[model samples]
Target: MSSKQGGKAKPLNQPKADKKEYDEIDKANIQKKKDEEKMLKELKAKAQQKGAFGGSGLKKSGKK
Candidate 1:
């Protein structure tokens, strides 16, 4: 009978997450992520030092 009821119903609010508790697994995972990030940085530096990957892969001849 009400206008609100005739319209779409509102969604229920989601429950908030509780405080995070870091256990041994969490600590190990975090360490692994850090190691991966460090390795990525090193690899990026090496790539930059080496210059662009293999250039444009085409040789331009001066002869027409």
Candidate 2:
């Protein structure tokens, strides 16, 4: 079966996929989510290391 790329919007009126295709789609979505999370983590780590925007911690306000 042909594989569809991630992040593409599916039409609401489209027919449902069969078991195998559905499984594949689910797997693809899971992978995409995981990859996105990993990338965000890496980016955050890099930012922390570089002190980008003053690392990952919240800043203290001098409120009276």
Candidate 3:
């Protein structure tokens, strides 16, 4: 029942290491995510326009 065995008393004075440099990869991943999100949004809009989920049923009202 010792406190040492219970994992206590670690001060928050440890120096944290810097993140690894993967800027190019990170940028590409972020761009990919943005593109994916944009595509999904567009698809959702298209599906809604087609009344895929019985949205407003106004998709065929033809106001455009």
Candidate 4:
């Protein structure tokens, strides 16, 4: 009988070298995303505090 006819075979385990490379890439991508999010959050806080183009530095504007 053919091997396929017997049953589905288990997939081969990943080699240590390939696994390490993938782990490093995954970690780098995660760190980069975290850094970008932190920067965006900081920019948003600054923008809210300063108003558009840092105009007037007041939280709200009022006509005198």
Candidate 5:
């Protein structure tokens, strides 16, 4: 294989990408993930508050 194909790139042949653009995109993705996690956590806490449907399900094994 040619050295260029399996080794250091030929700078003249490659197009350079803007670093600032990548940084902005990465920041936006991080913020979006944080928001989703917060929402899921809130939902779980709400569900645990009262799992039973107003005391109207299977009876307890040994309770009055």
Candidate 6:
């Protein structure tokens, strides 16, 4: 009979992983994505400021 409650036990000491070095192209791609996100945020803000669409109900004319 096992008294352990969890599924598996973890190791006491874990080795650290090496840091990844980005190339020029990778860096450029990352920067491009960030710029795109920024532009999208700006556009969204502008749209919100403009407010929602006009009334959906029927329009009434000036004539009786």
lDDT of each prediction vs. the true structure? 0.91, 0.83, 0.80, 0.80, 0.81, 0.88
> Which regions of candidate 1 deviate over 4 angstroms?
1-19, 55-57
lDDT of 6 at 27: 97
- Estimated TM-score for each candidate: 0.58, 0.46, 0.47, 0.47, 0.47, 0.60
Tens digit per residue, CA lDDT, model 2, 8-53: 7887796887665558889999899999999999999987787757
Q: By summed lDDT, which 10 consecutive residues of candidate 1 come out lowest?
A: 1-10
Model 4: weakest 10-residue lDDT segment is 52-61
Q: What order do candidates take by lDDT, descending? A: 1, 6, 2, 5, 3, 4
TM-score of 5: 0.47
- Ten contiguous residues with the weakest lDDT in model 5: 1-10
Task: Encode model 1's per-residue lDDT on 3-59: one tens digit a residue.
Answer: 556668889999999999899999999999999999999999999998868877677
Question: Residue-pair clashes per candidate, as listed?
Answer: 0, 0, 0, 0, 0, 0
Greater TM-score among 1 and 2 belongs to: 1
lDDT of 5 by residue, 1-64 (tens): 5544666766676677766644888999989999999999999998789787676888667865
Candidate 6 lDDT tens digits, 8-35: 7776886888998999999999999999
Candidate number that wins on lDDT, 4 or 6: 6
Return the clash pairs for model 5, or none.
none
Which pairs of residues collide in candidate 3?
A: none
Q: Is candidate 1 or candidate 4 better by TM-score?
A: 1
True-vs-predicted CA distance for residue 48, candidate 4, Å? 0.6
lDDT of 4 by residue, 1-64 (tens): 5545556878899867653455888999989999999999999998889766746545755876
